[model samples]
Each structure stands twice: as C-alpha cells, then as structure tokens.
Target: MKALVFDKSGLDNLRVREVPTPLLGPHDVLVKVKLAGVNPIDYAVVQLIPVQPMPHIPGAEVYGEVEDVGEHVKGVKKGDRVVVYNRLFDGSCDICLSGREMVCRNGGIMSVVTNGGFAEYMAVPEKNLVKVDLPPELSASLPVAALTSYHALKEAEVKPLDYVVVFGASGNTGAFAIQLAKKMGARVIAVSSKPWVAEFSDHVVGYDQVQDKVREITMGRMADVVINSVGNAVWESSLKVLGVGGRLVFFGGLTGSQVNLDLSTVYGKHQKIIGTTGGTRKELLELTELCKDCRVRVWRILPLEQGREALEWVAKGKDGRIFLKP
Candidate 1:
C-alpha cells in the first residue's frame, strides 16, 4: 500500500512510501480509501508535532468505500459508502456515554496520535463510520468540510433571524459556516479578505459589507453570533463585533493561537465563548444527507498522490476544500 509518511524534519521528510495494510479488530471496518481530506493539521503533523514513532500518515477526514467489515459491525457492510468521524473515542468514557465523544478523555485523534486516512487502506472502529448514500457527483471534499462546519454551527446554537457573522468565510470551514448559517435562517455576514468570495453568496460583494466595511453595515450593533476560524489575525476584530450577550464559537487557529483579549468586555457584555472541534457520526450523516439533496455544494477535488500540492494550496489560504483522491 502507498501512504504519505511524515517526519519531523520538514517537507523533505514527507514522502510516498510502501507500507503494510492495517490490521483490523472484530469491531473495525477496513476501508478502501477513495478520498482523504487535507487539513492544516496534516502539514502541522509533518513540521511541528513530534514524529509518531519514525513514520506517520497524517489525515483526519476520509470518504470511501468499505471493503470489509468485522462481524460485530452492523452499520455497514462490504461495498458500503461511508464517512468517518475522525475522533477515536473509548465507548465507555464518560464523554462518550453522554454522546459528547468529541471531548472524550481517553480517545485520541486518528492521524494525530494514530494511523490516519492518508493510505491505500485503514481500519477504523465500526462506531466511527457513518454509512451514507454516496452521490456520484458529490466527492469527498464536501462531506469533510460540511460536517465540520455543521458541527460548529450546531455548537453555537445558531437560531433563525439571528445575526451570524463568519470570519474567513472563504476558507473550507468558513464557507460551510456561511451557507449553513444562511440555511438556518440567520442573516449571514460572511467576512473574508478574498475579493471574489462574495460571488458564492446571492448577496453580492458590497451587498452587505466587507470586513473593513462592517462598521457601515452593522452601525455599531455587532453580530449576535460570530464563527471565527482565523486565529490571531482576526481574533480582536471578531471579539469587537460581538453584541452584548452574544456567542462566539472558536473552531481553528489557522494563523496563530496566542492572543491578548480584554477581560472586561466579556464580563461587562455577558457574552459567551464556546470552543468546538469535530462533529459526531450522526452530524456527519445529516451533513451528507444535506449534500445529497443539493442543499450544499462541494467545490473541488484533488488526488491523494498530490497530497503535498493540496496541502500547499490550503496553506495559501484558498477558499473551498481540496480532497485527496487516494
């Protein structure tokens, strides 16, 4: 099997190499990889994180077909199309029992701490796989981005008629956040530095306002809910745009995480700050259904062999997801 292996050195440490197929357990499913979603963490694992052993495959979200399944796996069978919930959690953990497996204490992320999806074959726990009716036209890129965005909005508890502002709306997670927030009946205010991003929305480029033009549109009111994925670059601005008692959902810190914040605003405004990661299996399933119904649009696909290229493009901060077809 051909897999992408990362060493702590740098890009030179990344290479396509032959590796043995993963061994499966009774409660696991062997998936023939079709597409692997390239995330920032993929590159981070290669450059920043300590090498897992000597070689590690870095990928989290994967969409593919089930080649075989363990006897205990009832949700899917051979030839079934599926999406995986990247969080690997112990079923007995307190968080898992309460259906909050994303925060499971004992579970570790597959690619980060274990073998991930960037390979010809990978074995995953049956509970982590969500069976979906894969549409021929819908590629892997859509599900991964949509699922993450869906989960982020769900965590924020976005409501109808709410003023929802999404920072970095052109990026993978932000794009989905914009559409999902709009679908939920919230008046979406998508913030992005990209000039053409607003074309995706029915509301034109100056239809509402750009990030710099926000003050004119909001008239000093601020948004009711702000979905921020850009880390330090927009953290202060995002915080400044929140109305009193509003909520802010933090998903990723793409630029840099460290930031200085004024504590008085949080206490004085009674605002809420929520942190979220990946989505649940059920949420991924719902996201797939939405895509199948043509409610969501997936924009791009790239082969797994070109994983490095995909990672580079994402690092450039492009809009939409880049799927690696394994």
Candidate 2:
C-alpha cells in the first residue's frame, strides 16, 4: 500500500511512500479509502502535536468501502459503503451511555490516537463506522466539517428566530454552521474576508465590519449565539457582538488559541462560554442523513498522492472542505 507518512510532526517530514497494509483487529473493519477529507486540524496535529511510532498517517475524515469486516462487525460488512466516525470512546462511560461519546473520559480522535485514512486502506473499530448513502466524493467532506457544526448548534440550543453569528463562514465547518443554524430557525450572520454568501444566512460581513453590521442588523441587541472556530483573531470581536445572555460555542483554534476574557463584561451580559470538540456518533448519524439528501457541499477532489498539498491548502485557510481520492 502507498501512504503519506511522517516520521515526526513537521510539514517537511510528510512523504508518500509504499508501506505495509494495516492488519485488522478481531472487531475492526478494513476500509479501502475512496475519499479522505482534509481539515485544518490535520495540519495542527501534523505540525504541533507529538505521536508515537516514528511514521504516522494524518487524515481523520473518511468516505470509503468496507473491503473487509471482522466477524464481530454488524450493521455493515465488506462492500458496504460507509463513513468512519473518527472518535473512539469506551462504551462503558457515562457520556458514551448517554450517546454523547465525544466527551467520554476515555476518548481520543482517530488521526490523533491511531493510524488514519490518509492511505489506500484504514482499519477502524466497527463501532466507529456509520453506513452512508451518498457518493464518496460528497460523503468525504461531511464527517468532520458538518458534524462539528451540528454538534455546536445542538449544544447551543438554538431556538427559532435566534440571531446566530458564524465566524470563518467561508471555511469548512463555518460553511456548514451557516446552513445548520438556519435549518434550526436561527437567523445567521456570516463573517468572512472572502466573498461568500448563503441563502440561509440573513447577513454577510467582513471581520473588520462584524461588530457594526451585527449591531445594525439586530438594532444593537447583537447576536443571540456566536460560533467561533477561527479562534483569537476574532475572539474579542465575537465576544463584543454577543447579546446579553448570549451563548458562544467555540470549537477550533485555527488562528491562535489564547484570548483574554473580561470577567466583568461576561457577568454583566450574563454570557455563556462553552467549548466543543469532535462530535459524537449520534450527531454524525444525523449528518449522514443530511449527506444522503445531498445537503452538504465539497469544494473539490484530488488524488491521495496530493495529501501534502491538500494539507497546505487547509493550513492556508481554504474556503471549504477539500476531499482526496485514493
């Protein structure tokens, strides 16, 4: 098998080369990669995090065919088309039992904890696979990007007519945020430096103009909910634009992580600052339904050998989900 492997965590270290195929565990499924979704976090993990076993493959989102399945596997088998959930958790945990497995105490992500789908084949636990009914190209982009936005919107408890602000609106999860928030009946305010607009959003503005436009649109009431995946670059502005008693659901640290929060301002406005990570299996299942209906959009598809270049595009903050075909 040919895979892009990095002996260590650095952009320069990633290389596409022939490697041994992964052997499946008794309860695992070996998927022949059809499309692998490249996300910003893939770059973060490759360039910032440390992992064991010298060489590593770094792709978390996958749309593939089950080339083989263990005897214990159910719901899906060989030749079944599916998407890998990417989050692994102990089934016995309280959170897992509640179906919010992403927050389990024993949780770890696919690319971060084990080998991933950057290659021609990936072996993952049967529990982490979800059957899908969409083309591999479109299905590739939904696993991580759509699920993250879905999880955030659900966690925020967005109500009909609530004003929602989405930072990085042109990015993968941000784009999905726009649509999902609107579907939940919230009026979406999309922020991006690029020229992008969604029919679902009520307004679109640049970062420099977010505070003013949001205030003008809401008659100074500001946003009822703010989803900030871009991190510190817009952190202060995101906070300032929130209405009193607002909820801010933050997930990524794309720009920079550290931000100084004013406690007085927070309490004065009765604000809620919540943090989220990769979504649970339950949320991913919902996204799979959306995929079947062709509700999500993928920017483009490239070959698996272009994994390095795709990572570069993600690091540079491309406009939407980039898919890679093996």
For TM-score, the strongest prediction is: 2
Tens-place lDDT per residue, model 2, 178-262, is: 8888878999999977665554467888878778999999999999999999889889998989999999999989788999999
In candidate 1, position 75 carries an lDDT of 77
Q: lDDT by residue for model 1 over 1-326, one digit each (tens)?
A: 88887755476667788999888888999999887777777777766776455678888877789998887888788999877778878878888888877778898777877888888888889988877776633445444567677888888899998878888877777777777787788877777666655654433233233444555556666678888887887888788778888898987777889989888999899999888887776777777766554332344676666777777777776655676666
List ranges where model 2 is wrong by over 4 Å. 291-297
Clashes (N, CA, C under 3 Å) per candidate = 1, 0
TM-score of each: 0.90, 0.95
